[model samples]
Target: MTTRWALLSVWDKTGLVEFARGLVELGWKLLSTGGTARVLEEAGLPVTHVQEVTGFPEILDGRVKTLHPRIHAGILARRTPEHLKQLEELGIGTIDLVAVNLYPFRETVARPGVTTEEAIDTIDIGGPAMVRAAAKNHEYVTVIVNPSRYSQVLAQLRERGEVDLFTRRMLAAEAFAHTAAYDAAIALYWQREIYGREHLPSFFFLVGEKIQDLRYGENPHQRAAFYRLPGMGSGTLAGSLKLQGKELSYNNLMDLDAAWNLVREFHDPAVAIIKHTNPCGVALGETPAIAYCKALQADPVSAFGGIVGCNRPVDKEMAQEMVKIFLEAVIAPFFTPEALEVLKAKPQVRLVAAGEGQGEGLSWQVRPVSGGFLVQEPDVYDFAEQELKVVTQRKPTEEELKDLLFAWKVVKHVKSNAIVVAKDGVTLGVGAGQMNRVGAARIALEQAKEKARGAILASDAFFPFADTVEEAAKAGITAIIQPGGSIRDEESIACANKYGLAMVFTGVRHFRH
Candidate 1:
């Protein structure tokens, strides 16, 4: 009987020994290099070193070990008579199975204070070459890259006495994806090192691992899936842990992200209720319970079945108040034991624990266009105290300034043509995604009703006309905050002065389109 050879080279040694032992018991010879060879031998299994087959010592600090012609010729050879004759002439034996995984490049670069030299050293050259060679000749060779596939491959071999062509093709496809993702990570790391993070690369590469497939997208007919981008730190909606409720839908994720992002803007205990990617209510308080109560009062009708986000842990009192209304989901840094018990009655509500509540600064935001994508830096800019200009004759009082700032933060998270009416650290009403600035202002002012008399209004961008200012005045708004870059800034300022309203221009715009 001919000897069947299985070459194994891996960085992650998970399931390596057990799989190799199973192959040995099935009368196959083990071929490995360096650490993999040592592991197999220590497990009381016979192994053949790659250097022994090539009759050449590994040089260049083991960097040139598996790059030899002897290694590639063995894995790439077909089972044809012509290929077999050439292998015999070169004194090379055909390798039936190849198991190889690349070095931990992603993990190495993700470490804090990781130097460029360390990242370069972690890149695997010969590993990718051998994996690709084996995968290309998968009609005759079986290539495995993922350690989790070891058991499945072993089961097939044990049952059929050989791996099927169908299974081999699937493994080959996975092997190529594994190499592609590894290369993409390396490319991005170098791109950041060569040109700073602020610069955009000529070529863009987006890589993510699928976390789950949703039942549907925005609508029932559309398909959707969730993927977690690698190297993005924890405390993100994608990294959140679900403690209860059904699987998250596409809209659930969108609303949860909006709520979480808005709540993170405040240092005090904050709560935000979001529906359809718009905040229906937002407020800050000394405790989460107080914040939840105030936030719910903004627009109780709109808050129904909305997603809730809290910067602090959900205590017993907060949970009790939350259960009174039907909420789609509630995400917080933590949930007290008493709170968890109180929320148990509403098992349908999603309970997500977002660790630490510290949001990472994202560098870029990518959106799909017709053919390709549009990439831009995230809207992370905030106005400094010096950037604020009192355009109106009457400056905002200390109390009005505080509410203006609060409303400004909330407006930044709202969609374009957004307007927010807030007072006493609580949002009275929010109008988002309107076509015209005045239309958005009317929606917010109408919702605020009598409450608008003492509240301040915030606009995401400069009003193109004085109509929005006039609308705010008609609603009895006391103060207004806007980016103030329009050509008609004088008209809006004059209008505010006429209405006895204080208006401030922030010099920065936060347009969420």
Candidate 2:
């Protein structure tokens, strides 16, 4: 066949110039539009303009570029006798590749004071159109929508003078994902502007590409991978820099996510240790090392192989102590050179830095089901213990109050509907991810074993029924803390009264579901 053609358009200008030059060297004709075309052509790349290719100049302020049948016919037509006849009749070249990234609606919305009009202006119509067309023609065209994929396409092109079928398939998947996410961001934005509501019609769209296959899942037999979601076109966990050894595991990611969330709850120097996707330990201290020590001492047993997150830069002293423990990952805002020297010795531990280096990711949660998924708002509670209310009679003593507050801090990190039992500034037991309220309490009690006798119990939510309160009483739980809003409040109160257990309702639920 004659030299194949490639179309390129992108809002993100990264690596576009060099990418086009490589395409020209590979003997593919590069066709781009407006700024993208200008960017490539000005850089001395042999980029053919869209107007030159389609015989149609951009109209409606460049909104009408690449919407013509000439563009679609080239990408969509398979290499069949009839298709060849039509292509020859119209002198239309086959588009074997399409590299297009949509406009920056997600980024525009993410700005500190971006207006609705500005966000709307950032939504690109023709860009998504071309991406969808190219993706739909996976059998004919290779589509690359991300700058990261530019290198991949170049490598494949250099190796075989063509992208392989598998790479083409994967690229097509990414192209469609790019368009889908673009539409979702636009829909989400319009929904908010028009209806003043965030939730719109459900289409169950999740667009991400696996950046890595993790070392392992939560268990040995299970498998895991990390996918990149274009969260506001901002930095993500997968995008973070790995400062030290080993690939992150499934449990490591879960714990890192947990720790990241908890530490972000406090702006000051804070430390958080996450175990089994729950914060078994958290503390704010004058120094980063002191905070980490306090957090580790909170629940030493549970902290083994746990993930740690710190808002402040981890110092040398903290890094030394961290090396002693078997940690899965250590994520902090930053690490001093001295701290890095200490962490470099432990290759098995994954050291991540916050911001770009640190993978404290954007706030979002997506849980999978058999046929579909359940997407809800993530819990981002930032409350101080002072805001908590004492809703019941018989106030807890100073010691019990300290444990109660600590347990409350820990309970927020547990899966919901959740409950945690603690004493002496350490978690004695944690019950999580149970269906019923009472079942969670029972699990916490059972986990606590004999330790629940004098420990303070903290529930993520109010008891729907009083059975959980009565059950905690049987376990000899002393002070109880919960967010009160249950329908059967009187019954739960009576249950707490029966056992003389001090119960306080903070009027704030810490549900993690």
Candidate 3:
């Protein structure tokens, strides 16, 4: 019987000793390098160092350990007679399997204040070369890069005495993907280092690990899965910890993200009720319970089955109030033990803990178009007091200014042509994704009804005409806030003055389409 040779080299030594032992038990010679060999030897398994096969000592601080022609030829040579004869003439043995994983380049760079030299040292050259060579010769050599596949590969070898061609091909594909993502991480890190985070690179590589496979996409027929970006911090929805309830769906994730982002805008105890990626109602109060009550009161009908987000921890008081309604999900920084017990009354509701603090690291907002993607900076800009210009003759009162700022924050998260009517730090009505600005205003005004009187209105963009202003004035709106860039902005200002209403221009447009 011919002696089967398997080469193993990996930075992550997970399952390495046991895997090498399995190969040794299966009558296979183990060839490894440096740390991997040390681990196998300590496990009392017979293993040959790569340097012994290459007949050359490892040099360059172990960077050139597995780059020799002996290692490459052994793994890449075919099983054909001609290839075997060439290997025989070169005194080289054919390696039937190669298991290699690259260095921790991503993790190293993700560390706070990581130096360039530290990051550069972590770039694995010989490892990727070995993995790719073995993957390319998958017809002859089986390649494994992921440690999770060790058990399955060992099982296959134990049962059949060899890995099948189909399994080898799949392993090769995975090995290539592993190397690709590794390279992408290195490329992105260097790009960001050389040209600042604001500079857009010619080639953008997005690498993600599959977090879960959803039951369905937005609809039942469509397929979908959730992927977490590499090195993502715990502040995002992807990093949220699920405390209870059924698995999150695609739509649930979407709505949860919207609710979380909206609620994060306020410093006070805030709550946002979201439906279909739009805020049905939002408010800030002394406590999360009060905020939830006010936000729910804004639109009780729309709040039904909606997702809820809170900036502060969910306490027993808040949980008690939340359980009174039918909420699909509630996400907060944390949940008290008493609160969890109270929330247990509604076991179906999803409880997620999105960790506190600002979203760590920079991220681009990405949207898919027909052929490619639209990448832009997130709308994290908040208007300063200096940016506010009272265009109308009447300046907003102190109370109206506070509500206008609150309404402005809420409108920024709404879809384009958005309108929000808010009073006393609570959104009374929201009109989003309308075709016309006046149409959106009318919808919001209609929703507010009597509550619209003395409430402040916020528009996501400049009014194209005076129609929205006239509509707001008729609704007894006391103040209006919008970006003032339209050619007909003066007309809207004149109408505000005529109605004795205060209108402020933020000098910024937040279109959330």
Instruction: Kindly list the per-residue Cα lDDT of model 2 for residues 1-513, writing each as its tens digit.
Output: 488888988888899888888888888888888889888878988878888878988998887889988888988888899998998899988888888887788877866789977886787888887788888888878888889899988998899888898888898887776777778777766666766544634554556657788777888888878887655222335556678868777877777767876776555677888878777677767888888887887668888988898878889999988888888898876689999999888888888875533333433466889997766666655567677777566778888988787678778888898988888665667788899978888877887788889888999988888898889999999889998888898898888877888888888888876
Query: What is candidate 1's lDDT per residue for 1-513, written digit by digit as tens?
Result: 998999999999999999999999889999999999999999999999999998998898889898887889999988999999999998999999999999999999988899988998899999999899999999999999999999999999899989999999999999998899999999998899989898899999898888899999999999999988886645788778899898999999999888888898888999999999899999999999999999999989999999999999899999999999999999998799999999999999999988783557357889999999999998878768767999898999999999999999999999989999999999998899999999999999999999999799999999999999999998999999999999999999999999999999998899999
Candidate 3 per-residue C-alpha lDDT over 1-513 given as tens digits, one digit per residue, 9 for 90 to 100: 999999999899999988988999899999999988988899999989999999999999998988888999998988899989999999999999999998999999988899999999999999999999999999989999989999999999999998999999999999998999999999999888899888788998888888999999999999999988888767888888999998999999999999998998888999999999999999999999999999999999999999999999999999999999899999999899999999999999999998875665456777899999988888888868878999989999999999999999999999989999999999998999999988999999999999999999999999989999999999999999999999998999999999999999999999988
* Model 1, runs deviating above 4 Å: 357-362
- Root-mean-square deviation of every model: 1.3, 4.5, 1.2
Order the candidate numbers by TM-score, best to worst.
3, 1, 2
Backbone N/Cα/C clashes per model: 0, 3, 0
Which residue pairs in candidate 1 collide? none
In model 2, how large is the Cα lDDT of residue 426?
58
TM-score of each: 0.98, 0.80, 0.98
Which lDDT values do the candidates have, in the order given? 0.93, 0.80, 0.93
RMSD of 3: 1.2
Clash pairs, candidate 2, are 353-357, 353-358, 354-358
